[model samples]
Target: MRCSTPVPAESDKLKLDWTQWIWPGPKRVFSAIEMARAGQQPWPKSIDYYVYSNVFVLLAINSNVLARGLMHWAALLGLGLSWLALWVAKTLWREPTRRRLNLSSLATAAVMIGAALLLKFHPFGLGPDLERDDRKALTLIIVAVVTLAMISWFFLVLIRSQQIAGRLRELDEQALHLKLARRLASAQIQPHFLFNTLASVQHWVDTQDPRAASTLRSFTSYLRATLPMFERESLNLTEELQIVRSYLEVMQARLGTRLQWQIEVGAGVDESLWLLPPGLLLTLVENAVGHGIEPSLRGGSIMVMVTARPAEGQVLIEVRDDGAGLAAGAQDGVGLTNSRERLQLLYGERAHLTLTPLSPGCLARLQIQTLEPTA
Candidate 1:
């Protein structure tokens, strides 16, 4: 099964619109929190809370209640408590651990109890005519608001954690599948390749042809370069090119004057500094020879080019064969499919392999985001 392409990294950036303000759903709220955690700017939800609290204060001032001053103070206190709740939620989102959760809960309860006691005792002496029932209702309202906010945040954090775990599992499965595909590709290619080369060598030796020794040497070099590739996950571009060159040389010996090839490195491209999945380029080369060159009456030339755009952090590798173009209703073989899967697993949407039909042939292009080589 083909893996779905991952979302682009830029899609994670917060770009709020009118719809998000009208109804900030869980996704938008979580994105706001993430932006705040990343130390970007204040999230819109925080601004909305402050605005709503001030609006409540205004409504309380305009009311014809007996304890207008008490209502004002209650509004202010609610604002402070809500802000504290938001901070607690942010902290929990950043580090959702049992220890932190317990600490935050204890702290919130302590603050709420202290506030309730202060309101009951009239410590501030701002609302002398406030009644017992009014105080009770006000206290209940504040506690309910704060408690609901906390509950919502806890559930949000829980859901986020579950999503993260699920994504990790998906990645693990993809990695396992990639490994199995690599082994399958190796098994499919090696025996048949060895048999064909050995047959050619045997025929040449029996005919006492002058090309036998050179062909044997090329075959030895190809085997030396190809065997260790399957054991590694990645290799430097220079090493990959070496393997491709060796394979092409062996092919040339077998199909003399029919297969011609060249490798070109563009300026500013340091082949040794760039890395690629093992056998990636060689797979393209093999496909070109098998499908494009060999089927034609007069085989054509193949060119491998490596170019880099450092400013854009992009690398492009093209394998072009001037032979018959893609056959009618042609589909990718196992080697091509495996190569694509490997690239997807390694680079996500940052890398892609595309085959474009040329005027007289086909161009297989691999574009990937460049990474600094590890020391």
Candidate 2:
């Protein structure tokens, strides 16, 4: 008579199938948030996952085999051992020598392979082979390929994260350089403005003009407003307009009927919420008087129109003059250049300054995005 092969009981087969099916649902619930914050990849976790998952896959392939309880315990033992290697890899991977290719990961894979072999061949001398030859070969190939792919994925994540960190540092350095350029440009212009204002005051006092006291008072107000522009970073539309009014008042006294101006505000504009770079309006007005009006034989009118669009969160500022717009091939002066640099530093592309020719003269239009804090 031929020797008969021993078989697993029906209860054992049911127990193994139920355990494999149920293990996956609860196992996937580990904290992904905590893993990200901790700077950990899911590679090791995947190794732990496959420790149990491989058994299920193997059982599916060999339907005639019944997985013993001891086999499950041995797989858990391998998972615990593989975790030791994963911890070692994580610790050493931080070092420069181990960053690209960590040997500890290879050791982890070796432990997982050993666990698969034990599952296929009964451990502790329990019994004959429960799995068929074809199923065993296929299961080993699947486990090995998955293990290698996970190791490669871990290294790719590390390299990409390092590249991101480097790029962020470069952006921060560029921002600092822009800030320094803005401060330097603003500082150089303040002294030149002060000297010119003083020279005008002396011109009136020395010539013994009867309007000296009134001129002195206007100068005082202009000085008080203009002095702060050198130090301030931003000003609201209302405060800036007041300062510009003081400046124009001083100029009107000097120019008499030769200088005529207008300041019109658009409806529904809340000056308190609208912001502008310091002295931006002053720069445009000064350019109008100096470049446009001063060159004309009879002088000209300077019109400053300020309109705010609350719906769009923008402020439109225009300074126009009736003097000769611009001579052929004229370039931006220091004042206009300084204003442009300040706008770039403060608002990047959100603010702009343009000098366009009005029929006879020039129109300086400045459009800036408003920054109003929420209520």
Candidate 3:
């Protein structure tokens, strides 16, 4: 069953680049020159790998045909199969890295070798048996050479593909990190939040209450202790909640009767769930206080709820404020922007955030699954 919010699903699938599916022409050509640097491949192989791989290609095709039928139907099928087998070996052998032959290459050589031995051992033995065996032996050597070529080609492709893929992944990660850094840097002091907290503190401090000033100082200490958190990569859900609670305490001391608050921590949220990027949970609370509670003028109440389902292995955080609520695109504050980017960086497509009007108030929801150690 779905909860108050439906579980989010991946909207896209991981995909390999289309170009990887096709052969890399330039790479193979360059690799060919490097492969034959030994110059042992006397021009015939140098001209085209097909010269070496053709036999295996042919054998594979013929085998497939034979498996289907040995009758007249298999006749042209066998010949076509043979040609295909050779083609496969020729292409595979041209690359030097695999440094070995493909199935087609080995099978082709085997087929020819088996056929030659069979004829030599025929009960009658072919006429001039020595000369017949001599011809077959020479052909066998050529086929062996081609098989080796195909093996080389396969290895080359494997190595090159891995290198290209690794580079692409690096670039993507770097782009994301830079974006995160920019968002964090722009999130210094959101004046409205500061203005509201400070205004409330000044209102109480003017009354000459030492407890109120101490509370205000404690609140300032909390802000100072937390501003450095944004520079961090991650902090756990428990740690984040602790920070939020400290902030709520500051607001409660200042607003007092003007603001009512509820902080509920669900028992299921295990400390071991995972490390979340810093400032995520706090962002939800900050928005509630900044937009939801502060803007009410007459003031209102906010509920901070945290639920964890350890068995299901997920966590949910909700900040609900019973105030004037919000309009479309109402959650575009700098803190929210920082949070969205941090989530995207950490989970790619897995984590989700939602903001909506809860009839009489505004609700900010965060859901996360698989909070295993990033390391």
Candidate 4:
């Protein structure tokens, strides 16, 4: 008698087939499609098609029993039909007319329902005729409906998020353009500043004082230092302080003994690590001198104090002067208004400029949230 060959075990057969049949073909397809579309796919539009296609394929597959050859063929058919549905959905509903969109959606739903029914019932023996169980079938239909609804909701949320992000980007761009325009407008030295400084130089020159030449030199240096403010968005605290010192030098030449100043920097604060909005500090200082000191005949002292509170995550700068305090119901002038607007634009609500009465003087305080240290 001839020896018979041994047949492989059922478990071995299943193991071999698992890799071929149980793999995620639909997920792979979706990922590949996503890659192919990439940035070319429009938001909201592509999302609808993607969701519809996925839901349709899932419904088609879930409505029938899975078999060896039947499963493979069903998957292929599901993929092809889903792709076709996607193409149609993308092309048909493009018109913004509400009636056309409604019609296309209805047509798509009808086709999907008909195909699902045909596959499940096998009316003409196109596939295996699964036994109909009312309870089980009803449960499956409810699940499919819920799944489709959830998918639609998810895509809708995605569409809304993308729209919000686009709006925010456009606002940022507009703000940036406005910032540039404002910077250009502010680039010029106020005519009165030049006239006053020149008048001081003329007074010195008429008296034949040796400091007249030095005063002109200081004015030139101040102009050179301030020119970069128009070109830069921000400056290091130390650099800004240098600019302020240059400004103070020029002002001292004009004010003579009338302008006395002090600057105090805080401990544990790295000036290089911190940044200031361009021209912000200078504006505050100018406001202090113009509004506080110039009006007083006795000549006053101005104090600039910078402090960082690491525990509180804040940086505080105070420009104070021993001169006249704020007038009651005093309206904001152009300098103060422009400074406030710039602070709001750059820091939103996280930064502010406050003018408060301080005993014999007023304090112009600029408070900003500190940034986290970089890695």
Best by the lDDT measure? 1
For model 1, residues 64-139, the per-residue Cα lDDT tens digits are 4425656666666667666777777667655544456556666777877887897688745544445765677567
Instruction: Score candidate 1 by lDDT.
Output: 0.74
Tell me model 4's lDDT, rounded to 2 decimals.
Answer: 0.66
lDDT of 4 by residue, 12-87 (tens): 7767434423221111111233333332335356655665567567656665554343444545554554555455
Better of 3 and 4 by lDDT: 4
> Global CA lDDT of candidate 3, please?
0.62
lDDT of 3 at 340: 82
> What lDDT tens digits, residue by residue, belong to model 3 across residues 120-170?
565332246344544354344435444454444455456544544454566
- Report lDDT per candidate: 0.74, 0.65, 0.62, 0.66
How does residue 172 of candidate 2 score in lDDT? 62
Two-way TM-score contest, 2 vs 4, winner? 4
Q: Where is the poorest 10-residue window by lDDT in model 2?
A: 22-31
Model 2 RMSD vs true structure: 18.4
Task: Please list all clashing residue pairs in model 2, or write none if there are none.
Answer: none
Better of 1 and 2 by lDDT: 1
Model 4 ranges with Cα > 4 A deviation: 1-176, 372-375
C-alpha lDDT (0 to 100) for residue 207 of candidate 3: 80
